[model samples]
Target: MARAPKDHKTNALRELDAAGIVHEALFFDADPAMTGVQIAQSQGEDVDAVFKTLVTEGKSGEHYVFLVPVACELDLKKASAAAGEKSVAMVRARDLLPLTGYVHGGCSPIGMKKRFATFVDETAQLFDEIYFSGGKVGCQVRMAPDDLALLVPFAYADLTA
Candidate 1:
C-alpha cells in the first residue's frame, strides 16, 4: 500500500507504469543502516522471496544484470556460463549509478537506459511472488515472478546455489 513519494521519481517505476505492470509498493524505515536481508526480515517476509539486483561485467566488457534471492549468493561462474561468457565480476558501487542510472541498494532490473544481458536465477521460479527494490531505498515492489520475467528482458538460469 505504501507508494513512492511524489517528489521522488525513478525510471524503474515510470517504466512499470508505462508498461501497465501491476505492482504494490511498500515502504519501510529508510534505514540505510540495514542490509536487504535485514529489511526483508523486518518486513516479516521470507528472505527467499526477496531479490537483490546485481550488476556484473563480463570479460567482453559488457554489463549484465543478475537477480537472485536475498537468501542466496550470485554465482559468477554460473552467470557467466549462462551468458556464454568467459567470466564475470561485480560492478563497483560507484560505477553502478552511471551504468544503470540507479544507485546501489535501489537498482531494479527495470527501466535501465539500455537493456543488458539479464539473468534471473532459476530459483526465482520457485516463489509465487517476490519483492524487489522500487528503484529507491526503503521502497519495494511486489509482483509475480512470471510477470517480472515477462516485463524484463532476461533469461532464467541456475545462477545460485
Candidate 2:
C-alpha cells in the first residue's frame, strides 16, 4: 500500500474532491533543493506542461492567484488587467503563508481562504494534461486543463510571456 501525502487535507486536494475533478496524485522523493522545472524533468514530464501556482498582490492590496506554466513567467500587466487592477506585483514568501494557508513552494491555486480573482495562462489551454503542486513538496496532481478551469473560477488570459 502506498503512504498518504504528509499534508493530505490540503486545500488543493480538498477543492479537487469537492468539485468532483478526477486527478492522479503522484508523489516522488522530493528534493527541497529542486525547482518545479527540475521536479517535472525528474518525473519525465515536459516542463511546459507543468503549471506553477503564483500569488500576486494587486494594486488594491488584494492577492490573486495566477496559474502558469513553470517555464513561463507571469505577465504582471496582463494579470493586473485581468484582475481589473492597475498593477500586480509578486508577493514575498513570508507574506504568502498567512494569506494562502500554505508555504511558498507548496501553494496551490485551489482552496484559498478567500477566493481572489484568478487567472489561468492561455498557454495552459494548449495542453491536454498539466501538473500542479499537490499542496506539498514531493507531490503533484495531474488533470486536464479544462477540468482545472472548472475547479477554479479563473479568467483565461494571455498572462504569460
Candidate 3:
C-alpha cells in the first residue's frame, strides 16, 4: 500500500497506476556510483527479490528487455535463446536514454519509450513480490510479479549465469 510520493511520480509508477497494479514505492539515498545490489541492500531487500533491467539488441536489430536478479548476471546464450535470436548484445550505454527513455541504473521493465519483448528471470516467481527500479535512481517499486505482468507482457525464463 506504499504509494509513490505525489511529488515524485515516475513514468513507471504512472503506468502501474493506470493498469491498477498495487505497488509500494521505496525511496532511498542513492549515489550515481551505487550498484543495484547496493540499492537493494540500502532498502534491506533480499538480492534475489530485487531485479535489474537490462536491454539488449538482437541480430535482427530488434531490442529486448530482461530482468535478472541484482546478484546475478544475464547469460547471453540463454538470453538469445529466450529472445529467439542467434545472438544478442547489450545495447550501448549511450543509446539507452534515447532508446528507452531511461538511464543505465534507473531503467525499469515497466515504462519504456516503446514496448519490447521482455523476459524475467524465473527466480522472480519464487517471491510473492519483487523489487525493481521505479524509472530512476533512488526509487524502487515493490509489487507482485503477476501485477507486473499487467503492465508489461513478459515470460519467465532461466536468465541468469
Candidate 4:
C-alpha cells in the first residue's frame, strides 16, 4: 500500500507529518518575478529566516538540494564540497518540474520527487523556526530546524557565500 505523507495536508506538509514533525504553513503569492527576498519582505518576515530551495546537479549526474536564506547566495565551491562532488551547478529552470516536481520559485527540500543529498546553510541554526516553500507556490512551512531534520536528512554547512 502506498502511504500518505503527514500533517497540514500539502505534500510538503504531509512530508512533515509522515516524519512525525510539527509545523505551520504560511500562504502567500508565489510570483515568478518575485525573488525570495521580495516574498519575505511582502510577508514582513526577516529575510534571513526565510529560505529557498535550490536544485543542483553534480558533475557525476546526481542531483543535490540546498536550502539557504532568501537574502543569501549559494557558494558553488562550498556546495560542491559539501556534496562530495568535484562540481555542481544549478539545474536549468525548465528542468525543475520534470526533475524535482517543483517550479522555480516553489521548490522545497522536504517533498522533492526523489530524495537527494540535502544541505541547509549553517545560518538556519540561528533560528528556532525558519520558513521555506511548501512544495508549491503560495505556501511556506514554518518549523523548528530540529523538526525539519526529521523530514530531510541534511547537514549544516557553509552553503552561503
Candidate 5:
C-alpha cells in the first residue's frame, strides 16, 4: 500500500524535519490504555524496535526524560545515576500536559515544551532505527538512533532492567 503524504505533522515530526533527520511516520490504532508493548504487538512491530518515552522528576526538581525499549522497565536506580540525582520519580500524569505539552499516551522526547535532560536505553544502540511516539498516540516515528540523539540532545545509558 502506498503511504500518504505527511499531513498531520506533530511537533515531534516537524522537529525531526527541521533538524535534517530523515524519518518515516507509521500510523496505527492505539488506545490511551495501551502501553508501548501493546502498541508494538497490535501493530505487528518488533518489540525490540519500539521505544516508550517516560518523563521523571529528580530530587532537585529538574525534569528528565528516558526512552526505553517497549518490552523493558526503566530501572529507577540506573535512571537516578544517569541523571546525576540520588532519586527520581515519574512525572505525574496530570503534570505531563503542563510540563511537556503532551498527554499520558502521547509524549515524545523530541520537541518538548522545555528541553529536559534526555537519555535513551543502551539497547537503542543495537538497532539502526527505532520507533517512538511522534508526540501523539497513533503516529510512530522511525528514525536512526544517531539522528534521534542529534535532534533531542540525549545520551545513551543502561536505563532498562
Candidate 6:
C-alpha cells in the first residue's frame, strides 16, 4: 500500500491539500550539505524543473518570495523590479526560520509564516510540473505552475540570471 500524503505532512503539503491543489510529494535522503541542484540530480529530475524558493526583504521592509531554477542565479535587479522595490536583498539566514517558518534549505513558496508577493521564473511554465522543497529538507513537491498559482497566487517573471 502507498503511504498517504498525511504521512509526510509539512506546512506546504497541508496548504496544498486545503486549497484542493493536486501535487505529488517526493521524499529523498537529505544530506545537509547538498545544494538544490545536487538534490535534483540525485532524484533524476531536470535541473530546470527543480526550483529553489528564496525570500527577500525589499527596501520598503516588505518581504517577497521568488522561485528560480536550482541551477540559476536570481538576478537581483530583475527581482527588485519584479517586486516593485527599489532593491531587494536575501533575508539573513539567521532570520529565515522566524520569518518564513522554514529553514534555509527547506523553504517552500506554498506555506509561509505569512504570504508575501510570490513570483516564479518564467521558464517554469515550459515544464508540465516543477518541483520545490516541500517545506522541509529531503522532501519535494511537484505540481503544475497553474496549480501553484491558484494555491499561492504567484506571478511569472524573468527571475533568473
Model 2 residue runs over 4 Å out of place are 1-3
* Model 3, C-alpha of 73: deviation from truth (Å): 0.4
lDDT to native, each model:
0.85, 0.84, 0.91, 0.87, 0.87, 0.90
Positional deviation of residue 24's Cα in model 4 after best superposition, in angstroms: 0.5
Return the lDDT, model 3, position 80. Answer: 99
TM-score of candidate 3 relative to the true fold: 0.95
* lDDT tens per residue, model 2, 87-155: 999999998888888788887787777787888888888888988888877668899988876867777
Residue-level lDDT for 19 in candidate 3: 78
lDDT of 4 at 159: 94
Model 5, span 1-161: residue lDDT tens = 12534666888988988878889878775677887888888887889989999999999999999999889999999999999999999999999999999888789898899999999999888988899888877888888888887877899999987
Better of 1 and 3 by lDDT: 3
Which runs of model 1 end up more than 4 angstroms from their true locations? 1-3
Native-vs-model 5 lDDT? 0.87
The deviation in Å at residue 155 for candidate 3 is 0.4
Per-residue accuracy of model 6 over 1-161 as CA lDDT, tens digit each = 12443457889988988888889989887889998888889889999999999999999999999999999999999999999999999999899999999998999998898999999999999999999989987889999888898878988999987
Error of 5 at 118 (Å): 0.5
RMSD of 1: 1.5
> Which 10-residue window of candidate 3 scores lowest in summed lDDT?
1-10
Each candidate structure's count of clashing pairs = 0, 0, 0, 4, 0, 0
Give me the overall lDDT of model 3. 0.91
Candidate 3: which pairs clash? none
Instruction: Report the lDDT tens digits of candidate 3 across residue range 48-114.
Output: 9999999999999999999999999999999999999999999999999999999988899988999
* Model 1 pairs whose backbones collide: none
